[model samples]
Target: MELPKVGSIGEYIRQQRQQAKISLRQLAAQAGVSNPYLSQVERGLRKPSAEILNQIAKGLHISAQALYVQAGLIEDREPDSDVLAAIRADVTITERQRQVLIDIYESFRKENRAGNPEAQPTQPAEPPPDAAVHRENTATPDSKEG
Candidate 1:
């Protein structure tokens, strides 16, 4: 697999931190690193170790595996399911809560699949072609309403 370009991981980290609305000094304090070190990492002036990456991940409330993949320390795997992505993206939930929900969801999906050997996995069904037309026909303008 092609390796990520230099500073890509730093860019990813910066993006995540911004998305999380965390300050550099706050992150550094949480990750137990110096502010200058974290700044250097973000600027690609320094390459952080895996352990430091893990600490930063914890500080950002994200998975270390995600950072590892971004840093090209690990291979990117299959994309997560919509449900898994939703759970992981929810900032209101704690990391432990997210893991528990994901585990439960996967277990239920596995059980459902196991019960029916020939059943296909569920995907969203497309709306019928005429559905939009029907809605347009039924919808009334303000002037037409009683």
Candidate 2:
């Protein structure tokens, strides 16, 4: 797939922030960035780092992977289903929750693929070691969210 122009990332970020009804200053604050820097980034005067993009994604209540795709840090690919897209696009869920849902979805997919050898691998998706910890932790009310 063709990637978006580098300059469009700024526009994407600005658009997401606006859609969230956040002012420039408020978004900057939420992203733990300086207002001037974020303003520069929004206007395409400055390129933001990946870390900044992640923070901006968090502040905008959007997907970091989506932002990464827009920024060309990652290749864009169609999701397997609307359910996956909806999970990524959901604004009400926390990032951790989104990840958990995705993990479960991926596990199901792996189970299906294992049953049928004809299914091709799209990528080498390795679950993080801490994913098990997350599953275990979620079962306990006292577990602190990272």
Candidate 3:
């Protein structure tokens, strides 16, 4: 996919901010960025980092992934399901909390796929050393407890 121009992304952000009925100064304050920096970003004179984009997304009450796609940090793919969209759009939860929910949802999907008999088996990957050690430590009987 062709990457969107930085100016286009900036324009998109400007449009979103306007559509949300938020002033540039208010957005910058909410996003925890300086007014001049935000102005530069809106003018396409500055490219924002992922962290800044996340803050801006939160301020705009939108998904960070949407901004990431517009910034060309990620490829624009198929639209998310209504459930996933709702999860991402929820403003009451922190970003970390949203991510945790998404992780759990994806894990359940993977588990469901694994149970399907028609699914092709893939080669198992080696577990990380820390995970291996954790399993071993939990599996062993506590000799000291007795």
Candidate 4:
């Protein structure tokens, strides 16, 4: 699927909402915004704040980073690994989990680049020990435990 161009966050949001088979009223209610406000946003008449965007992302059951990227709030990076792309595209995992994985992956890339500026970017970063307690008690949000 072709992504909406950057700065066209409204179009992107609308597309995602439609793709999810949600109506405008349903999305507005799910997103916790007024229907008129959401309509304005979709029509490009109003720009949504980060908080609103976050709520919309949650309502869409998608990674907030995806919205942020389309909103131009996050700088879109291109990595050759395809791992980052897959991570973002994965709908099975919770948004928080996706973010943690992305953070770890980017950190690894940064470290690698720092150590060898000429080295090509590669390797999917593994979750840190702290990120994995493997215990029910330490579960993060959306985890079975919490």
Give the TM-score of each candidate. 0.59, 0.52, 0.51, 0.52
Please estimate how well model 2 matches the true structure, expressed as its whole-model Cα lDDT.
0.79
Clashes of 2: 0
Candidate 4, superposed: residue stretches over 4 Å from native? 1-6, 77-146
> On residues 29-81, what C-alpha lDDT tens digit does candidate 2 reach at each position?
99999999998888877788999999998898777987897677887465457
* Candidate 2: clashing pairs of residues: none
Cα deviation of 36 in candidate 3 (Å)?
Answer: 0.6
Give lDDT: candidate 1, residue 112: 79
TM-score of 2: 0.52
What is the per-residue lDDT of model 1 for residues 1-146, given as tens digits with 9 covering 90 to 100? Answer: 65344666787788778877899999999999999999988988778899999999999998898789777788645455778767655656655677789889878878777886555467789998777753356555865867
Worst 10 residues of 1 by lDDT: 131-140
Stretches of candidate 3 exceeding 4 Å from the true structure: 1-5, 79-146
Q: Candidate 3 lDDT, tens digit per residue, 1-146?
A: 64344555677678778867899999999999999999888888788999999999999887788789778788645355566667655655655576688778777767767897655457799887678443355544756575
Residue 139 error for model 2, in Å? 58
* Pairs in steric clash, model 4: none
Worst 10 residues of 2 by lDDT: 133-142
